[model samples]
Target: MFDVPLMNRYGLLAAAMSVLLCATAGPARGEEISLQKAVEIAVQNNVELNAFRKEEGLREAAKTKAGLLPNPTLELSLESGALTGNSGENAFSVGVSQEFLLAGKREKRLALAQKELEVYRWQLADRERLLRLDAKARFYQVLLAVRKLKLAEGGIELNRHLYQVAKERLAAGDIPELELNLVQVELARSEGAKTAALEAVLSSRAELSLLLGGSEVDPALPTGPLEAGGAVKEAQGDLFRLALERRPDLKALRAEAEKGSAELSLAQAEGVPNLTAGLGLKRDTTTVEVAGLEGKDTSYTVGITLSMPIPLFDKNQSGVREASVRRDTAGSRLAVAVKRVEREVATAYASLSNAEQLLSLYLRNVMPQLEENLKLTSEAYQLGEVPVLTVFEEQKKYLEVNQGYLEALNQRQQALFKLEAAAATELTGGVH
Candidate 1:
């Protein structure tokens, strides 16, 4: 049965609660920066990426230079000088010559330039991926610091309470003054821990700020479980093959080898020699009789000349040899990169697996036991059956376990990040 009056009351209560939450959450949400926002800021303002952009512009200019035609050489001369005492016999000449490329040098250079550009494109993407990984790692560090500070503050409060209880108990002769003094000393220690944790939080924030272009981040931490990240995918077959296809550094090396091949070919092409041809105008003056008429005559003569250097002494064998050796070196380096990627993938997988198991054990077994023990010990202390110091001792153990759990989770995340770097792929979209 639908109760109209009860339904109305429940609807009003839900609406009021929604309004209250919004009212309280508005300012905090405004000041808080999300992980996605942090990544965006870092990527957009990254110094290395900006420098790469400038270098890209320079490479494009080089491509343009590679495609340009050779400029012509201009020439001028005086055939007869006045010192010969033949003023009217003076002859002047003007000529232009151009050397035309005989082999596929320009095309090969352009192709190599394009490949180099492709390499830079992929390198830029790889760089961004690394930058985003760094930002996410620092974000996680900040969250860890925030959690530690909370633990320290709580420890201080609990120890201060114990100190108070000890004072009362000592006044009534229920316990010795030594216990009270010990409790006081413990409270001081907690305060020291709290101070160190606070300093750590500040230092973490400063580091993150540097990554984020010096913008100060709010203290309100990211709102999510640290373990909430992408799972490691199953590697079915040929992960190395995938790395070869995707790894940008490897691609850059391959591009260098291709460029070296082109360079070697260019050196051989230079050995083929370019044809240089010249066209010129020569002035000639003579007095002669053409058939039956005699008159003073002026004439212009057209002259053509062709020349090229013989490939006898320097046939570019040294240049070709140098380029071939460099190409071989690039290939060897690529092989080394392949070996490195394979090892990194295997090692990272092992670390991630170990971290996963330890985290599971802590959550499923150790954490609960520690929590139960701490709760019971605290209750016992309140009932005067146990010393307050005993409760603190249990808490100290609990704190260590929690800290270890956080560290394990951190290691798991690090391993995943390393896998991403090695594979040139994202394990997580990185929002976590």
Candidate 2:
């Protein structure tokens, strides 16, 4: 009678109840924060996300750099025969040259920078999506720990009551010392379980504190239901479609493909050599001795010149090739991302379905009978009608059944979190 399979089958359930109780105790040490609050804190204060946001500034600066024109060149020259001992012969020229971008290279470069900025925005959004998911998961873990602590406390109360009954029976000469000793042992075990459950609450809260960027000494208590109401109403195929439409990582990859296309276009534009035009004023003063007579000549002239590279060999062929490869690689990655999302949605969908089924079983069939059974068994044992072992078994069943119910609740919430993360879209009726 002491070796009941029902209690053993739901051992994990009891652990979860103990966690819940401990969570309740946590509020006394620190203020309570709801799930939404936790998520907001994580998004705002997380160090990595803050650092990643700086990239937006860098991308914006790149756009400014891309749109700017090349600087104008200034040229000045003096030609003299002084070095050759003919200082009387000298010339001076002043010129300004501007290299004009040809084939719309500047516009193409600006377009590429814009596409790059889009890709980074999507990437950062995806990172925030992941961060939100992690915060929710950690919050749920703390909730589970609190529930487990509650279960442990309940167990202790039941064991203490049973111990009193056992002592009474032993004192009345109706039971042996060994039976009473068994109840004391159970009571002590319950106390130890409570201690462990309390420790679990602290550890879970510490984890959540780290995620929320809070001090561990003052970790906020999670304030929400362990069994928050939510359901997955969409079919697997529909969820997969939603993932394709909403997943930021997938969006980032598509943006990257567009960026690669822009890069290729820019590379082709760069292959067209730029035109440099110059305008200059020239002055020359020359002196010469001809026919034994000294003569001097002074002249001034204005001229315009235009020049360009021949592009005989390197026409950005390597750059074009690299960009083409990049575009192809991006396309391949997007295809792979689609497949991976499909698998994730399917897996999370099935997991949610299974958790719901288990919780339904506990709610409709098993849990309602457990309390009455334990009550009757306790009364019968006290009246000397049932064996002490029967009381122990029933009490164990009571605690484990409650534990199992909470465990199912926790598992369902965990499944919901995974589904939301996989799809990269918030689902209705999820933990709040």
Worst 10 residues of 1 by lDDT: 20-29
How many clashes in each structure?
0, 20
lDDT for each residue of candidate 2 in 89-128, tens digit (9 for 90 to 100):
9999999999999999999999999999999999998888
The estimated TM-scores of all candidates read: 0.85, 0.88
Alpha-carbon lDDT, every model: 0.71, 0.82
Which residue segments of model 2 deviate by more than 4 Å? 1-31, 216-219, 289-296, 429-432
The residue pairs in collision within model 1 are none
lDDT of 1 by residue, 195-240 (tens): 9988987998888877876564555444444563766775813545
TM-score of 2: 0.88
